[model samples]
Target: MKKFRKIGVAAVGVLTLTALVSGCGTANTTNSTPSSSAPVPTGNAGTTGKLEIFSWWTGVASSKALKALIHVFNEKYPHVQVINEAVAGGAGSNAHAVLASRMTNNNPPGTFQVHAGNGSLYSWVQAGDLDSLNNLYQSQGWLNKYPKSLLNLITFNGNIYAVPVDMQRANVLWYNPSIFKKYNLTPPTTFSQFFQDAKVLKAHGITPLALANHGNWETTLLFSDVLLGTVGYTDYNKLLHGQMSWNSPGVVQAANTFTKMMQYTNSDASALHWQQADQLVANGQAAMNVMGDWAQGYFKTTLNLTPGKDFGWAPTPGTQGVFSVVSDVFALPSKLSASQKAVALNFLKVLGSAEGQKVFNPLKGTFSPRLDANPSDYDAYSQAAMKSYQKDQLTLCIGQGAVNPGFTTAFENAMAIFVTNHNTKQFIQSIENAAQTNPLS
Candidate 1:
């Protein structure tokens, strides 16, 4: 087994780059341990050996999409070894624990995954744990490529920390066309209409929304969108920022509204994973699923469904229309050799490339963070999502993207409790508690 340990710098003021070990064969799995027995490895990867990377992308379709990106990365850098430390379990748990421990001990992966948002990145940047990439961003002009909403979130204090990998779109409704036809139902355009349609499906003995409650992310996704549907984006931000409490009517009403929607989900939903819920909709056993755009990758790879021809995708209706989005971005550590920094920057540039956008997002079943990137190249679901996104006027999906992960856990637990115990008031209170209690960057 490869040994791992954490190393701390003797010098307090200098920026310390986190360490990653090398020489794991191609079959390496996630061993979150940061070993002290070895020197922090570095080299001209493309001219030499592998570039070990870590991320939470162990799902079949997602892993496949990731491999495709790696293949693209290899095409131009054939000599570089790309070892994937993709781990599964705990709904990003394995990676989270490893990274948190790493950052705490001042050890970070050469490349690890993290969400780009105000509340997540600011502290790390201030601690000298992250590297600055203003020159790279200025050179590539990421401000022009990535949407202002996303770019703004990645900028902490003033510096960009991460290389955005993909845009994770929320508020998508993936429904079986055959099931819709059988029920004589059309996709809803309003909350009232959606409930009425749910009744129509339930009356005919169908689960209106296929969901998996075990992983809190799913519940949180809906929770974020519900706030949007009930209150609109501006007010949701106010509530999130502590300008208003959950007792405020909008938060309470959103919880109450979600309480109603919970009735139409599958009875066994609490036992299922998000992928299993995707399967339920795919098999036509359930009528719809409200998940991120990545859900399309599952439908494409598992059920082999073609978008539009066999199924359809749309955003949930809101009083004021907008897209709720999450993003995955990569942050580089400091003190790298000039060549290594160049390679990292080059890789980031490619990730934003038009070809990269076309190949990666479609395979990942996600949206490109780039506004000017072409959407016509993606699957039907993404195409429709992009269309709605362009027209709806974009807004941050706080529950998924803006909320701190620590608080997200709180809200998810509150949602589960609310769903099981029928406690809408407590649900509202829990969100308020998070804003007040949890550590926001």
Candidate 2:
């Protein structure tokens, strides 16, 4: 979540994306034409090198998914040794900082984890630090597999910078099904209903909403969803892309709505991490938690719970038909040695391949970015999310990787302050000042 491409008004056009439910066909690498200077091995003939895979995937589920992906890569290229350089932190906060230091010091990793879209990928491209993967996309037959909007996020100046492995929906309301059933409540679809549900649950001594803001991004993410819900998709896009003013009535209303919702959250939210907050819902101490689909991995894999049975999901209240997308992508540094570049690009090929997506997405609690990924490979909740992503109006998550780093930092700073104060007027003024100072492009 460092910084990436700019998905402004022009980039937002393709966000109303069509579903990526296509047939599962094999990926063909017949068109791969490696440059003479940096010769890429079409096959694993003499591939032997150390590939440092850098990411912030040290969590149980994510680490397993990373291993699975590496296993696949290793199977094809047995000679290449993979170095897992995973740093622990929520939202790549620490890893990206380390990565930035390494990159600036000309000690770039073979490939690094980056959120796709108007995030860190764009910043890298702007600084000429990343190599375009257009050739790899073509060779892997992935040009038409992903959504145009998704591809647009990683593309700058007609060149693609990253390979998105999976897509996470940020606008998900994860709830304890048994708790709801015991309370004779259903999943809320609108803010009013959510409040009513929260009130009922709170009356029964339950934490109505579980929130974690240890790094402050969680609250910002929640606010982003609230903004989308209050303003609707069109205006939401307008607001995030700088086309609409931050001081707009919709933004103020959204801020107010976010504040109201915060009343139902746990008092200890500031002290908890996301997983701890999620555990509250899982342990039945909390009724609901609004988080990204990655929570599914925790519930299913780590907690050994079943989707739809142990837990239930719906769009965050009033955010129905809107998919707030946050994708994890990998990119190669432009300055790697030719041999290192070859190995890194090979890893990228695997990352972008249909085989790689199918293998990694399910375990990671996300769906593949590829259109050709089979729905049967996923769970009940994922299937539903897949359908929603296909049909829903796709909006980017602000706290994730949807804007310039400067604007993102300002926006996050404003959110951190707003979460504590809950002053709507001050929040609006702060954000307006941020947008002006950072210039949201």
Candidate 3:
């Protein structure tokens, strides 16, 4: 077990490159120990203060999950007040922008949401805006609760910076089961099969694929799936880490594949948000959608759909047996007052506890990062995703936390232009130029 642990840490550290990535729910106290029942892990016995919890979790399902977790926290510590300072839009883009301004003005929140991976979390550490959480982890017994590879992503200079809350698989292909059954089609496992299905659906006047790029990151997310499916995991990681060139044959092929996929997407893709695109599939207007497991939350909680009944999911074409990790984590700001820090640290304890995860992940449509989180606490989709996370090959979700921000910015720019122009050559060229300035490694 120890030998495997070392390899897991090393392998994930290389593939993940150091930060964790981004998602959930409610309380079902079955057989497991409930963290809410334990005393507050930190702060004075009568710790009474306001803790501003910040994040981009203002969506219907996510907001509900956060509320549930807060409810549990209040049960444990009635004196502490939690201020839900969530900003909406851009899949965390708008919230992050607001957070940046607050941090710059020395008005940091007590604790804030961050992607668990290196891109966002480590960058904050580099900026000296976060405090180390090693003591918190030790106190919570989290050093062994979460996977070492996951912890490795949040650890910088031997100090862990954040506590991961939930893990979301980003390479999922969600579809309306009724649409597939009516068409007598199966979910595609390969590109050729996807095109075939798309062709059939299109001929029948159905939009084959549902896409939303309002955030400018959704298109990049689609391209990432295409790139991974085309080049396979090994080269995908290489390309992400800058060991492989942007103009490599695999990337070109991926760009071409992505262009082909766009033909089957709805004409109004650019105008729709991700949820709207997902709504198309739910309404049977679109056959399928490529998105993270967070879509599962929307389908289950917001849309009131049943898993494996109204909706079905599979790995994006050619991505079977691979898990593209997108995790959401929380961290303490360095500038908090002692009282603020105490309350914040206690909140982190609840956030990292098994009881909190059980309540939060089920409602949010994500899986707990902790190894001990009960599978029965989740739905069918989450159960499958949890098994995949345990058994499959893990890769970083592109644009989430997989690469440096410089490359991510350029990649997103290239994707935005490519969607409008379908200029494959120019898209590749733009990415190549960005690689020159912002090396992925």
Candidate 4:
């Protein structure tokens, strides 16, 4: 784990160098035990102060959902001015660079959104830049509120560092219903079926898969889905944890499958971001897209398309029984003053509460991290997703910080090259090289 610290520092240093060289354009890169339930101190509620939150969810659905959550928080703590310092970028690419700079300069935000996994939390913990929420969890009774499996991912060295607000299934295959019907195609449940549908769609002049490689992380995300679908959840987890070799036959097969899938994507994929790729599907230019469930929000809210009617969804091929988890959480930085800590913890309390989750997840196109969130509040897609989540084997989304940030970036770089070259051997070797530098062991 100490190696993870070096990886974090080195990655931040690289970002600093890039910013210095390139003039800092929207740069892209990519805790604790708690006590029993207790009353939160509100002596400072009358004091007026600002709470700055940093995140990359500046899109319509995410931004709207966040604002709703903030509105609820503001109602209770009216004196505290909540400043949303959201950076616009796909998968925290730009926001991360800004955060790294802020942390490096000793000017961290009150609390910022982070992935609830080893990749994100471990790096900060290793750097000694984050405070634990063990006591907070104990006080809030959240130890038992969330799933033990989920709690395990956020917990490190017996401390809970962040409060998970929502969970997004990353292995979702979303498609235009009209497009599928026009071609007489059913939603694919197997890779063979996917290839078959892709052939049909291509012959009819439709892009089989909508992919965006502009952010680089989108490509890695697509690869993660393909890898999971090809290798299955167990081996995929093994690969992510370094228990399985990157050069293994399963990984090689997954890489080959990824290459094959890339063939069906739009030629302009490299020019677009994830949202643009999704638009290809939404507007009926493409047949399908593999993305997190957040696309559901974009379709419903931004595009005004109804789920199960305008669009449809299914688990990615060979992943019907698996749930690829990408949870969004908020963590407190260690540099907060006593007053800031109190306000930050209060904000986290709302974020972790069932009330806050119910208000946020439905609008965000995701399910709540809390097990007890009412299913009636969500839409048809989220309701089905929540049901699947209850029974499916859960796996971490490596592209979304389930591993290590340095390794994630390395894998994304390899994927970026693979997208253009389609060189399987080089892709596999690049992954192996990345694993060597940041061993999961």
Candidate models: Cα lDDT each = 0.66, 0.81, 0.81, 0.80
Can you write out model 1's per-residue Cα lDDT over 146-219, one digit (the tens) per residue? 54445555654344567787877777777888988877888876789889989988888889989897776678
lDDT of 2 by residue, 97-178 (tens): 9999999999999999988766677778777788777667666666667766677677665566788999999999999999
> Which runs of model 4 end up more than 4 angstroms from their true locations?
1-47
Error of 3 at 157 (Å): 1.6
lDDT of 1: 0.66
Window of ten residues with lowest summed lDDT in model 3: 21-30
Model 2 lDDT, full chain set:
0.81
Cand. 4 TM to true fold: 0.90
How much lDDT does candidate 4 score? Answer: 0.80
Clashes of each: 6, 8, 15, 12
* Each candidate: RMSD: 10.8, 6.5, 7.3, 9.5
Q: Which stretches of candidate 2 lie above 4 Å from their native place?
A: 1-40, 43-46
Give lDDT: candidate 2, residue 377: 97
How high is each candidate's TM-score? 0.84, 0.90, 0.90, 0.90
Q: Write the per-residue lDDT of candidate 3 for residues 1-441, one digit (tens) a residue.
A: 011122232233211212222100000111321111122343364368798999999989999999999999899889998899999988888888899899999999989998866477766777778887876766666666776656766766556778888999999999999999999999999999999999999999999999999978999988889889999887887776667888999889989999999999999988999999999999999999999999999999999999999999999999998788899999888887767777888888889999999999999999897777788898899999988887676677678754567777887888889999999999999998998897665
> Model 4, range 1-441, lDDT digits (tens) per residue?
100111111133212222222321111122333322223446664245789988988989999999999988998889899999999876787888899899999999989988877787678767777887876776777755665556666665555678999989999999999999988999999889999999999998999999888888887887888888888877787788778889999889888888888889889988897888889998889999998998988898888988899989999898888888889999888887767877888888889999999998888888896767788988899999988776677777778877788899899888888888989899999999999898765
